[model samples]
Every structure is written in structure tokens, then in C-alpha cells.
Target: MTASQDVLGEVLADLRAESAELDGLVAGLPPTGWAAPTPATGWTVAHQIAHLAWTDQRALLAANDPEEFRREATKYLAGPDAASFIDDGAEEGARLPQGELLAHWRTGRAALEEALAALARGVRLPWYGTSMSAASMATARIMETWAHGTDVADTLGVVREPTDRLRHVVRIGVRARDFAYAAHGLEPPAEPFRVEVTGPGGQVWAHGPEDAGCKVTGSALDFCLLVTQRLHRDDARVRAEGAEAERWLGIAQAFAGPPGGGRERRGAPAPEGDG
Candidate 1:
């Protein structure tokens, strides 16, 4: 379905802001910093940024040339390395010189933005596991960017200042509640649960029915971290009022694809990457 111009503009703007913030963080890193391992098992900081760039290029292709994307995707899925495709892409980009890789990411990001903004009416871009409108695609980009950026930040021992942009991530997390259950081979709840979380700006963002029996309430930041699988359930301070809601929190996921084996408890060493 087509998205309203006003809302699409807002999401695209947020996408740019989210990308730029991470770009700024990595742009200042020295060459050695690129080799420094992030929490993701085998990914260094370079791998993290490279993954974003690689995915951005794929998105650009999906938006600009669907026929080619489908052909390429078919070949990819049928290939021997299909299971490792994501990691393989990151590895290929990670091998480039830091300067070259950075430039590649910058160019790709710009082109993707142009493609998404210019998408024709009634066009829904095909993506792995689903299709999405320009706005949905852009919002997903922001979500992934934030999730991976968290890994980079953790690697550098930097604590990013939370922002209201997390609202996009939060929205996805809540929407994906059933996807989480299905991903885990469990039956989805029959009814939706009420979700309310306080954003970084101290604004309460609420979703689902107000009178729903199952309800979740807590800090938006914690919920985002939980859904992204960046923070373990035990480490998050979010609360749930019903059994279904509580169970959902344990498997909450905003990103598409297989269930992410979430990071270990707060004190445990984090898995190599958030993805």
C-alpha cells in the first residue's frame, strides 16, 4: 500500500538522522579501531559498518531494480553459502580498506535514500521475508542501524545518548510480538496485548487496546533493547501484567527472520553481534 507523503517524509528524515549519528561515531575511529572486535562473535567494527553498507546496497537494488534484485536473490538463495549470506556480505565489505569501505557506505546510503524517496505510487519493495512500502522499508533501516550501532558503541565502551528516534524501533518491536512467537515455533496469542512504554523524551508511547487483559509497561529504551535482542530479558526493567505478555517479552523481536538468540544477562559477555 502507498504511504502518505507527510508520514513518509518524517520516517525518511529519521532514517537519515539515525544513519548519520552512527556514521559520525565510526568516522572518527582510527585504523586500529576498525579491527577492534565488537560483541558480535566474529565481527569487528568494520564488519558492523560494512554490514549496514551491504544491506543498504541490497535495499537500493530492491527499490531501484526489482527484477534484478529478484534474479540476484534467487541465485543467492540457491547458492552454497545461502545460510551464511548475511555474514558473507559483511565479511566481503569488511575486507576493504577502512577509507574505501566508509566511502562505499556513504555512497550507498545516499543512493538508497534517493531510490526510496522516488519510489512510484503503489510500489511495494520486495525484501527478505516480506514486502514493504517506502516508509516501512525506511523505518526498518533505522531499526537495523540502531541495533548494529549499539554493538559498535559497546565495542568502543561508548554509551549512546538515547533519542526519541527509538520510537520507530519500539513500534516495530511491539508489532512483531506474534512474529516472535511464530519464530520460536510457538502459537501466537489469540488477542493483542496492550503495550505502553516511556520514551527517552519521557513520553508514554502506547500501542494495542487500552482495555486488553494482557499489558506491558516500562521504559521504551528497555523495550527496544529487548525486542532488538541487544539486551536480555533479565537485564531489562520492562514489566508485563499477564502470562502471555510476559512470555512475549522473552521472545520479543523487531527484526525479521529467525529468532535471535538474545544476548546473555547483563553481566555475561555479549554474543559477538546483535544480529
Candidate 2:
């Protein structure tokens, strides 16, 4: 199998595992916890779960009608406080009963998987403002699941193991370095950088050139969590090898769109025993 396919397979596995974890967490949430506030401002656990379901449903629909998808998304954004509205949807999703919310999430996820599985290899699907193939789309989903899943896990004080599958999400974050740079009105780094993530069971996932001018080295989970802004930069588990690499490290983003609020560098110290 091709490297991309292998990476994609790992991503699919992560998605399934994350979905199961979310199911259990949501299912076990008490009614009050469902409405409890998450770290996201003004959002509750319910909103996050709901947003996932809604986004999956949208993805399934958009995969079949790219133009219409763009139009609808544009329209959605045209509304006043559209960004806040979208955030509200995610935060409010957990308001429903555990069973009902889980059912919706499962249904949307299944439809998305089916839609993606049916795509022809190399066929690009419209997303945000770019075109992505089935593999890329799947990887994006994996990143989203892992990033958002962190929020849920944090609220519940649950520590999740770093799976090898997170490599895909990390890769997406690495690839998006340019986007993040551009979002800040800065030019992207001229030279490519190396990314190394230490996975579970002592596995290491490396991307970009081996002798790249810059290097990002850390535990796979920490790297993923850091780039996604789920964890702060000073979390102490991630490290950079070059000045440019460290600059990119401060503003790394995996998801689409402009740079977000950005992340604070304050957190715990890096963990010992680098991968």
C-alpha cells in the first residue's frame, strides 16, 4: 500500500477509536454535566457534541454537491456573528439526552464514512476554500475528532493515550504550517521542516525532509495536541530544533481558515524521554 493509504488507514482507526471514546463519555454524562461549561467560552459539552454531528452531516452533503456546499457555507457565514453562531451550535449539542445525542452523532459519522468510502481515488472534494481528496478529507476528520475530543476529555479530567493513528492529524498540522503563517500576514518559511512524533508502543512518525532546515520533535500525542492548540506551547512535552521551527511552533494550526486566537506558551514543563 502507498504511504498515504497507510497513513489514512491509521487515521480511520483513530477516528473509530475516538468515536467510541466520545460515545462512552457522552453516554455517561449526567444531565448537569451535559450543560456544564467547557473550556471554550460560553459553550457546554452538549454544544461540542452537537457541532460534531452537524459538521458530519454537512460534510456528507457537501461531498455530493461541492458548489452548493460552498454557497450554503458562505450564506451561513454571511449572518451577523456567524462565527459565534457556529460555536454556539457546537457548545449546545450536548444539551440533548445522552442517547439522543449519541444516535445523531453515530448517524452522521456513518453517513460521512460511507460518502468518503465511495469517492474515486484522487477525486477532490471542496472544503473550506480548498479541494481535498478522499484521503485528505478523512485525515481532516481525524484531526477534528482528536482536537475536539481533547476538549471533552479535559472537561472530564480523563487522560487519553496517544495512538499511532494521530500521525495523520500531526501531518495535516505540519502541512498547514504555511496556512498558519499566511493567516498572520507573514510569508511561509522558504525551507521545509522536519516533523517527528513519538507514538504509542515506541513508534515514531516522521514527515518532511530528514535534513530539513527546521525540526519539530516530541511525543506524537503532545505534538498533535500542541499544534491543534488543545495544549499550550509550554506544556513541556514538545520541543523545536531551530529558530524558524520554534517560530512556526508558536503559531501552528491544522484546521482550515485564518489563524485562531493563537495559543499561550504557558503550561507544564516538557516530559522526559524524547521519542
Candidate 3:
């Protein structure tokens, strides 16, 4: 279901907050830092932000002119490797001077936000996967920004400040619980699963059947990191109860696309405050 105006406003606020935080992380980086390799294999800091800029521009197209967006997508799909689109685009974009890439991202995000706010109520916009409401699109944008920001932060040996804004990411993770199973060609369990995550501020955010037999519980940041595939589920503090919930945790994903071949065990250190 689409969020009401008040809820959408909150989501948009969080989206801007996430972008601002990421901007701070990359704003003053030297050329070396921009060229630094991130956790995403073969993607540098420039590649990461470049992808965000490209995506925001495409998402804005989806919001304003889906037909054109679909046509462009069809052209992209005709390429040999559909999965390599982001990688290829990022590599190309990385060729631009660092200042130009950053300026492009700032402009693209502003345009995307404007386009999203102008969307009519109850109207669904086309996306790479399922169509989405403006609220969902905004939330998805925030989730991606934050996830990529983590990679950039990690490469620089910096820690990002966490916030309750992650609740949007956690909500999407819970909602896509069944999709995770289906993406693996497994039938989602018939019964509902309970999810309880403690946010950064210690506020409890719960979803699903309040009395469901299955449950997943963990720190909200850990849950978000897991769903984004940034942290290996096994390496996270998140735990599950009941068979289906346990399996879901093993393959959970909030982002759209084929199930990601998630990050492997690297003895990766936990995010700030995760311990």
C-alpha cells in the first residue's frame, strides 16, 4: 500500500537526509580517494557515486516518462549482459572528472526528488522490477544511497552516523521477505513471520503478524545491512525463530533484481555501533 502524504513526507525527508549524509562523506575527497576501490568488487568510489547519479537520472525518467524509460531499458536489455549495465555505466561515468561526477549526482538527485513529489496519488511508476508508488521509489532511492555510502565510507575507513531513517529500509526488507524466497524458486511459506528490530535509538520497530509463530529479531542496522546484502547474514547479529523465518534470513534481499550472490565471509568488521 502507498503511504499517505504525511508518511510520504517523512520518507522524502529521510531520502534527503540520506543524500546529505552521503554528500558529506564524499564532498571533499581527493582524487586518490575517488579512485579508491570499494567493497563492491571492482567498483571504485567514483564508480559508486556515478552509478547513483545514473540511476537517479533513470528513476527520474521513470517517474516522468515511463515509456521513454522502458524504451531505454529495452535497448539496455538487448546488450549481451543485462547484469553488467550498472558496472559498465559506472565505469564509463568514472571517466569523468571527479568534480563533474559529483555535480551530476547533486543535480540528478534534485531532479529525481522534484519528479517524485509531482507524482499523482495512487499512480504506479515503472521500475526495473515491479512498479512502485512515489513513496516506495523514494524509499528505494534512500536505501541504495545508504548502502552504497557504506561502501564508500568503508573504503575511507570512516563510519557513517546511523539514524532511525533506516526504519524505511527495514520496512522494505520485511515486506520483501516473501520475494526473497520466490526469487530462489522456493515457495514462500504460507504463514506470516514476525519481525522485531530495535532501531538505533532503541525504539522497537515491528512488522508482520503480531502473533505469528515465525519471528526474526535483531538490531535494525544489522537487519538493514543484511537485507541490502552489504553484510553476510551469518555474520550479522540478526537471528531467526521458526523454519521459514530462518530460511528467509538466509536469502533476504530488499533491492530488486535477481537474487544477489551476496557478499562472502571476509571477516568484515561490523558497522559503527553495531557491537
Candidate 4:
């Protein structure tokens, strides 16, 4: 579907809101806090923010100059160990001082916001995997911001509040069901499963055929955590009624990449959000 200005505007507004929340979370962090280890194994809080900043920079480039960005991506992919580029880039970025990294993140975020705003309606931009309309891209950015923001919150031992903002994230997660299976070199189930999430605002968000035998239902926050790989499926309240739906819960991922080894049930502290 073509992106309309109003839809894009709403997505952008959500993106900004997610960024503002994360910005507040880290604005007062001391050096030690920035270096504190998070649940993502080797990544510290600083690495989380740095990774977001680096991605924002790349997204800005993709929006403004697709051809140039593709050329660079091709070259980067041709490197002997190119699969490590994301991890390597995050490590390299994490070397900056906390203050500098925060500043860079803010600047990169603004640049990307501006670049997206300038795109014409219905415009699609190239990403690491497939292309996305401006609206879709904005939603993806919001999803990432929230996902990483949770890691930051976890590291600080702070609880975040659930908001209606998660609607965007949940939508992307449901939409990405097929992609998640494909990433694992497995064929997606032919039957579509119904998804019914009760959002924080008391709104019920439903997708797919309502009569589908397989179904997933639960709190929107839990579903978002599941799709983002932030919480183990066993730790979430989300229920999958059928085999296909259960499989989806086990392997769901919102962001594009190789199928991720999801967060383990290591007695990791549950994210302090809605149940």
C-alpha cells in the first residue's frame, strides 16, 4: 500500500516519542552507568546507544542517496568477514566517550528524521534486506528504539511504562511472521494465524483471518518483547493455541537479519513493563 502523508506523520510522531523516552533514560547516566553490562551479553548500555546512533546514520544515508549507499553496502559485504560488520561497527562506535556518543545519537536521529520528512509520499527506500516505504521505515525505527531502550532500562534496573506507542511495534511483528520463518531457512506455514493483542490503552489490535485455527493472544507489551527478541518466549504471557502459532512464538523477530538466538530464560530479570 502507498504511504499517505497522514499515516507517515503518525509513524514519525511515534518514532519521535520513542526517541524522547530513550533520551530521557540515558540523559543523566554517569560514565559508570554507561559502561554497565546489559542483558545482551557483551554489549554495555553505551553499546546499545552507539548501535542506535550508527543505524540512524546509515538510515539517513539510505534515504538521501540510495545508489551511493548500495555501492558502499556492496563493498562492505564483499569484505572477508562482512557478517560481523554490525557487531564490529557497534564495538567501534562504543569507543566514543559517553557524552560524545549521546550527542552523536541525537544528531544522527535528527538527520534521519529530516531525511524521512523530505521523502515524497509513497517513496520506498532500500534497506539492508528489502525496501520499505517511508511509513514502514519510520515504524521500524520506532521498533528498534523501543527494543534497545528496553535493554538500557534493564541495565539501569528501571521499569518503563507501557504506552499505546507499542501499536506500531506489534503491527510490524505480526507482519514479519513470514519473514522470521524464512530467515531460518524454513518455509512459513501456509495457514495464517490470528493475532490478538490487548494494547496498553485498552485497545484490541487484531490481524489476519479471525477464524484461523492457530492464534496468538496476550498483552501487547509481551508480544513486542517476544518479537524483538528482548524476552524469552517461555517468560512471556503470550499464548499460542496451535502448532504454527507456537512455532511463531519461539522464533518471532521484528528486525531483519539471520534468525537470532533469542534471549535465554536465564532468570534474566523480566522487563519492568506491563504484563
Model 2, residue 100: distance off in Å is 2.9
Residue 145 C-alpha lDDT in model 2: 76
- Pairs in steric clash, model 1: 39-272, 39-273, 40-272, 40-273, 41-272
1-275: candidate 1 lDDT, tens digit per residue = 33487788899899999999999889989999999998788889999999999999999999989989888888877899776788899999999999999999999989999899888766899877578889889998999999999989999999999999999998888877887898889999999899999998889999999999999999999899999998889889899999989989988889876776679987787664446
lDDT of 2 by residue, 1-275 (tens): 67766655655666778778777877877888777766555556787788788778778877888789888778777877655655655556656676788888998898888787667667788776467877788788878777777777878888877666677887898888888788678899789999887887788888999999789887888788777776667774878998999888788888875555534454533222100
lDDT of 4 by residue, 57-173 (tens): 888988999898898788877887566777777888899998899999999998898889889876788887678988888999999999999989988989999999899999999
Quote each prediction's TM-score: 0.94, 0.87, 0.93, 0.94
The runs of at least 3 residues in candidate 2 whose Cα sits more than 4 Å from the true structure, single-residue gaps closed, are 1-10, 77-79, 91-98, 262-275
Runs off by more than 4 Å, candidate 1 = 1-3, 272-274
- The CA lDDT of each predicted structure is 0.89, 0.75, 0.85, 0.87
Please name the candidate that would achieve the greatest lDDT relative to the true structure: 1
Judge candidate 3 against the unseen true structure and give its global Cα lDDT, from 0 to 1. Answer: 0.85
- Candidate 3 residues lying further than 4 Å off, grouped into runs, are 1-3, 266-275
Query: Alpha carbon lDDT of residue 173, candidate 4?
Result: 96
- Best-fitting candidate, measured by TM-score? 1
| TM-score of decoy 4 | 0.94
In model 1, what is the error at residue 227, expressed in angstroms?
A: 0.7
> Of 1 and 2, which scores higher on TM-score?
1
